[model samples]
Target: MVQLDATTQEVLNRISEEFAQKGAYNLRQNGVALCHGDSEHIKIRKKEDKPGIDILIDGDTKGERVFIPVVVSVSGMTDLVYNDFYVADGADVTIVAGCGIHNSGCNESRHDGIHTFHVGENANVKYEEKHYGEGNGTGSRVLNPVTNIEVGRNSVFTMDTAQIKGVDSTVRETNVELAEGAKLYVLEKLMTDGEQKAESNIEVCLEGSGSSAQIVSRSVCKGHSLQTFHPKAVGRNKCHAHIQCDSIIMDQAHVGSIPEIQAEHVDAAIIHEAAIGRINDEQLLKLRTLGMTEAEAENVIIENFLS
Candidate 1:
């Protein structure tokens, strides 16, 4: 294993703990790939023409989860990476991916990552990714991520993505296609403070009979930040799909939620819901009665709501 600097190590720890990465692991810093684990069922290697990693999970493999962490600790740098994941037929696996940036300089730092997943028949995959940024300097922290997923017949795919704090700007896009009897579930959580801006767009297609999908997104905007969310689901067969978007807006912030559902077949069913509001005064009052400060009470409420 390769050694990391103190600052880089701290950033990695914040994203994923060391003990949680007992299986296959890959660590990347500032567009450079380093420190990858070796496993028979899981394979991780660098791309031939890009600063990225390719991960492959063998068929019928079921055991510990795979962990991959990417971090950028320098300022004035733009990093781009492309990750491709291939899961074999009848395999069951879990993947944990974390990306973080620690920029303490006057220049802006940004990361753009594109991920594509190919899930085979009867396979099940659970994927989790978190994004975070921390710095005291005047630089902007930005992240742009795009994901594409293809699920085979009778397979299941679930994804959970979260962005906690300190990111100045972000644009996230996701697309998924489901085959016969395939299922997909996606959960997204986001928080923006200061003058940050974020935009998220998701599209799912149920192309085969008995395919189903569900998408849920929650966001909090504070301190003049701006956020926009768009979720669209299309059912082309006798499938079911649902989408929900919820947001909390505070302190001169702005948030917009747009959800669209389309059913091409007579037996298809699709629904969507969206809600945007601020913290409840009744809840805040109850917390204040417990001897908690206003700020602390608000924080508690936000944490609980997001959780």
Candidate 2:
């Protein structure tokens, strides 16, 4: 196990709490990496040619699921990390990864991460990631992330990502490809306050027979924040795809949801839906009847809606 200072530990704890990370984990501060875990079924190693780590899950592994958590905390610096994951056939694993910025410096802090996943036949993978920022300084906290996923035949992949608060700006892009009998599910949640801005673009391709993909996005924008969500699903064969986007905007906040569904084959099927609005008055009034203040009631409603 690697020892961490008080400030770094606090950042890790926040990341853990937000993403529900437990058990085996890895921590990276500034640009240094520290990892601790069992090596029998899960292997984590730094990449000699890159600035990040590689996680490998052995083949034919079952029973207890493997968990890998990664955290990055830095201030007044731009950090870049590249993570590659390989899951062998019939393996099941979960990964929790996030980044937090603790900036009390004069310069802005930022993090850019690229993640790629290779899932083998009959494997199942669940991945979750969250981003947060906190500081009393005048520096901006920015994050940009790119994800690429490839799932083999009969495999399943689920990805959940959330950016709850404290980020100044972020742009996220995700691309996924599914083989025969493979399934991909994506859930994206985001909340932005202050003058923060966020943009997310996701594309999924169902290229094999029996392949399916679904994407659901939820977002809340407050205090002049701006957000945009674009999710596209393409079916190239006898497959199914669906996309849904929902958002809430308040206090001059702006949000846009654009979903595209394309069917390239006669047997392909695709559907999409989008909705954007504010807090429901009935929901708020019902909460207020419980002796809560207006602000408190709104908060409760928003939390429930996002959850």
Candidate 3:
């Protein structure tokens, strides 16, 4: 692994210790190491106007594990991109990605990120991603991640992701394609508590026989911020798809959810349901009478519904 700065190196060291304690698989790329079967710190490196890293498949027929942690300290019109992560046949892999930014005082600091993954036949992959940002500058950070997953026959994939408040972020899209007998499970979550904008777009396709996909999403929008969720799932012949999205609004915030499911074949079964509403005053009043303040009551609603 490349030697990291003190702060990042400490995160990596902690992950390494956890790996030893849990007996997990270790993955190394360009000297950077990550562990499977155990959680590890995300890998973050500074890339000046270029693709950060690319993973390729060769020689080995088995899959590999990867961990990515990104810290955006760039200021003044910065750009960064990365190539796709490749997974080969008859193997299983896991990826844990984390993104965050420091308190840069620049007014025009922004970051753009892209991640792509390819899954091969009979392979299984589990991916988890988290985004966090905290700063007091007028500069806003943007995150546009593209997840291109091609699941081969009998392959299984799962995704769990969460986005926190601070800075403006929009996930352009999450596109998934499944092969025969492939299965996928996805959980998308977002929580906003700042004076920023947030949006998420996710799409899944069941393109082969016996393929299936499911999505569960929860969102919370507060303050003067706005949020939107657009989730779509498509099922072809003999395929199955399901989607569920529920949201809660507070503090005069605005939220919109559009969930749709499309199935073309007679043997296919697709279902979608979505609901958007605000925290009722009746509920808040009831909680306030129970020794909770207005802010506390609203927080309870957010935690129970969104978290």
| Highest-lDDT candidate | 1
Worst 10 residues of 3 by lDDT: 15-24
Q: TM-scores across all candidates? A: 0.97, 0.94, 0.79
- Residue-level lDDT tens digits of model 3 in 155-198: 88899887755557665578888899999998877887666677
Residue 276 lDDT, candidate 2, scale 0-100: 93
lDDT of 3 at 43: 27
* lDDT value, residue 93 of candidate 3: 65
Could you say which candidate leads in TM-score?
Answer: 1
Tens digit of per-residue lDDT, candidate 1, span 85-203? 99999889988887889999999999998999999999999988888999887899999999999999999999999998888999999999999999999999999998999999999
lDDT of 1 at 277: 95
RMSD of each: 1.3, 2.1, 5.5
- Candidate 2, residue 91: CA error in Å? 0.3
Off by over 4 Å in 3: 1-50, 56-65, 280-290
Query: For model 1, what is the C-alpha lDDT against the true structure?
Result: 0.89
Candidate 2: stretches off by over 4 Å: 18-24, 63-72
